[model samples]
Target: MIDGLKPYAEMKDSELCWLGDIPAHWRVKRAKAVLRRIDVRSSAGAEELLTVSSARGVVPRRTANVTMFQAESYAGHKLCWPGDLVINSLWAWGKGLGVSQHHGIVSTAYGVYRARDASGILPRYLHELVRSSPFHWELQVRSKGVWISRLQLTDESFLNAPLVVPPLDEQAAIVRFLDHADRRIRLAIAAKQKLIKLLEEQKQAIIHRAVTRGLDPDVCLKPSGVAWLGDVPAHWEITRLGRLIKLTTGFPFKSDGFTHVDDDIRLMRGINVSPARLRWDNVVRWPMSERPNFREYELIPGDIVLGMDRPIIQRGIRLAVVKEVDVPSLLLQRVARIRVRGDLNAEFAALLLSGRNFASYLAPIFTGISVPHLSPEQIKAFRLALPRAEEQQKIVEDVTVRTGAIRSAIDRAEREIELLREYRTRLIADVVTGKLDVREAAARLPDEVESAEPARDEFTADEESDPIEVDDEAEIEGVAG
Candidate 1:
């Protein structure tokens, strides 16, 4: 998967628009010419549900990470077999196409296809070729819709698209080679991810110490009478969340009243709340005309917003602090706005809630497995410790500096992972497009490549296992990118 690898011994111009050249013996064909469409729908409306992802191939939705829109029934869902191909119409441009290794059902919106003749092409080989940039580019061109990014890759369009096919044996060799290479790359990525996790933990350690205790190493300490927390500064005060903050629940805004237009006030949903921040990229809006007295729902600087549903992710709470740019936004149901009373410092309160102590308490109270939910009372019941006004500001300022260095390390590690992902994408494009010869490399792989090993980093066994119920909002809250 590098520039030094030799190209095919002999090559010819394939004369295809996306694919310029290929091995002389390889054949250039339309997707439909080499594949037949599969249109079998679930007669019983019951089957193992499946999902398609950018990195991982099609896997059972029940055994995959949380996905969007879990259907109440699969009655109209299309049936797909182990060797078939599935393409997510809306996100095909983002590498949302793959070959399924399971016999299950998928949403009707997806396009399913079976090889017209298996003897002529390998499904695994086609999987890589389809995911390669050339095919992705072709799909984008064939996609038809009003929005450029969200184009639809309909059945007819996807089937008619072009593909480059190598002989069956060579195709097998390519899959084996790429698989070995991918495993190696994924392992490296996993190590980087571990490093990032460590850095984050280091940052959190600083915050936990500063907020729970105090900045002074020799400060007199006393027990707060809480099991999770050991000792706090002798001068600090202990209180319930009800005493230190004013909490307001978001209104239940009607769905039909929602709009994407600019004239409306942005409605902050559970999706907008991420760990310690608000992501504005995919927010829905409330029409200013039909909106109720939503001004009361408007957020202001220093207010902390937390998702009432599935607020805990990987054992940490998700909080978003309102900034000037984030103002004028109204909160929607299952989300709550928090404002600290004059007795508690706002910044100190946010840091405290974002810590592990807050999450541990909520974990036992929220009952749902897939979709966790919390009542307003459960939130107010939290035990909190407060420092004098001046001491609170000192702790916030000191913790900020202490975590800054650790955060820098985490950011650098994250960037490395992104670069590695980009490289892996390019490597696949080069290999599938006949830019590199990996026959020798594929044959030289170690025996462990064939053994069952958990894919790490962005993908993992836990991430790909049975229906994860955290609450309906978890699906919207934890989207990758």
Candidate 2:
């Protein structure tokens, strides 16, 4: 795409420290001069409730993950019209602001603004500019707070920022060019994601068969006497999970007491659990203290950690086996840690919890509610199929080797997706800041440029949710608009 693009006819300095050069025809202006704050409040609280996500931008609140915060009445929330810019005040430093495409009621915590003059300033253009990589650093610097998590973007700090103004027609062209480029990139990623899902399903089928029935396909079968288990090897035993495992609750650490540091005590939360294994990215920490009882909470290699709250992801719940790299960490509240005892093989138990068959056992425990959770008793009461100890170990080893190949393919696809997303970000920064002129590219763009329409109201029964473009950066930053 870059090879086919051309540069501008003329150039000039932007007169801003952060922004270097720009097209000669464009002018540099302070953000305050181009936009004004809007503070309209809905008296009837009738507008659709909306959320701001770094991944999906300003969307209906229910569409995005509200696992962290339950939805309440939207009364007294700030009102926003389509084309207005909405900023997640606390997370603006992470580019958690976007142009709204729906008329809705946003949390009072957000800052809403509209263009003072649409002829020289467009909401779409402004959205791309403020979210550009350069602006991320700029917002971080201007944000006011003592710590990173608590940083806030005040109206005075946000509205006074620098902006580059272009002709309205040029803004529209750039938006169209980027929209078309973004859609193509997303379509490619969707294909890779689909492939990964199929591979996972196949891997689960392999696990379900091995863990339930013995290795020999011709082995004699007998009724397991459990409704969920139709028939198992004649020699296998049907046992309760409590007979072979000891379940422990996670430590209830105070959130306000938490600190951020590399060497501090690592706290494992639900986010660390992945389908294939545990992930250490985005770890939270607690200060190292003198309490000796901490040793009891510390995890050892091969210990089982299961997410107990809002644990479901991508239509399934995933469990993790602690490795040496993940040790020296204490589990946080809303997570369950299991210790193996008696004749059960720990590896086999962990894999069983990670399989698709486990979903049926979990279905009843996860009643539709604001926060879905499983009690310790419910986990212990789960029926377990016990094969010979030697057979259990062999099955674990066999499944590991088989699933490893599937995992490898998924990893390769994920890396490619990451690289594609990086290219998208760079392309946007180059074109939006005048480093690259895509006017010709825009003209040649396909006529079906994606519409930047907000998803349907999640609170309504008659509406069907539309697929929205999820920005890759949303992962690094927590959540934003």
Candidate 3:
């Protein structure tokens, strides 16, 4: 903590209401007291423009990450200059404020304002103040709209708002210190992202190895003679998918037939199956009474579900395994249930379906003009390399053990990344709004702000335009036109 700062006990009750404690000597004031609205206009074809982004603050016009067709025409927008505070009034409640560093036009929705004086209020400090929790609460209290909420902060309402301001020098120092800490956090995030990418690549390699080559590298190899598979263990047989598994089409149940029941039975559909797992959340319900010949479509432990619809088949791959032979679950028409037979291991067969070689084999068989689909006959005829059951189990075990470890590590890193992002948001909210003393920390910050540039101004009124006409006169004019 910085020197000369103490717990905010000495402040009067009215001076500090929501914020539990503050530094003894600090004074509380409203946000409007230090904020002034700056007004300027720009023509549509203004050469230089500036855009404010939710992620990156104010940035040059060309640097924004928006589709060109979606951006403002730039014909009639507001003008902005370096050092002015630009805030999106509509999005201000979400912390959409930043100090501009480029000269250009901005969206009309933004309120471009300058501080009354640098001595009393620093631009950086004010930027932080508007993002404070209390300030956001104020915005929430004042905003009004049926569906699209709008916050209209009048001059009086703004200036009368109060906040605790540290000394001018301390404010600057805090900004500098927080800036440095932010950079470190960002760098750590980048490192974790790179690690994730590398782990994913490793996972792909493991899958490719297990499916194409058996676990024993010492085993003799031979040409599977299948173009997609290329080669396999010498002892393995090249067989059509139909030979190794019984691929059965699912029963078509009408929407009217679906009933809400408190039963353990699950109806598997194309949507229920993702790449590697089953999503049971948005499942359609069916009554046991409606299930005629349910045993014909019942899912068994180790059975793999493959979607036959075009959209779902494109992401077809492997869905999930019936880990337990529990209650009867019917398969929907758009899905194909593959039950391993002959000398094939169910897990190994499922792994093959999830592997690259099988995907390559099935890709060409998908038929359709717009949404490509796979028929049961086409899927059955798909060629694959089939190893003996014992070898298949070994390969599945090896791949699962290795990939599971990598997946666990990746999941942990992803969770850490998410927490870091949340921490970053809280930290910025605190330092920027003066909730925490960050002046001493700010002095140690690196000069450069190294995140991606702000997104370009791409205001789409078609999206933001009001659906209902505000005035009867306007409605009449629209009808007349």
Ranking by lDDT: 2, 1, 3
Cα-based lDDT at residue 451, candidate 2: 54
lDDT of 2 by residue, 124-205 (tens): 8888888888778778888997666678999999888778888888888899888877777777776776787787788889
**C-alpha local distance difference test of each model:** 0.74, 0.74, 0.61
Q: Higher lDDT: candidate 1 or 3?
A: 1
Model number with the top TM-score? 2
Question: For candidate 3, lDDT tens digit of each residue in 171-214?
Answer: 77766665555566767776776787688678867978887887
* Of 2 and 3, the candidate ranking higher by TM-score: 2
Off by over 4 Å in 1: 1-3, 8-25, 43-46, 67-76, 147-151, 216-234, 240-309, 320-341, 373-381, 450-452, 458-481
> In angstroms, how far off is 216's CA in candidate 3?
8.3
Model 3 CA deviation exceeding 4 Å by range: 1-18, 47-50, 60-68, 132-134, 148-163, 208-399, 426-481
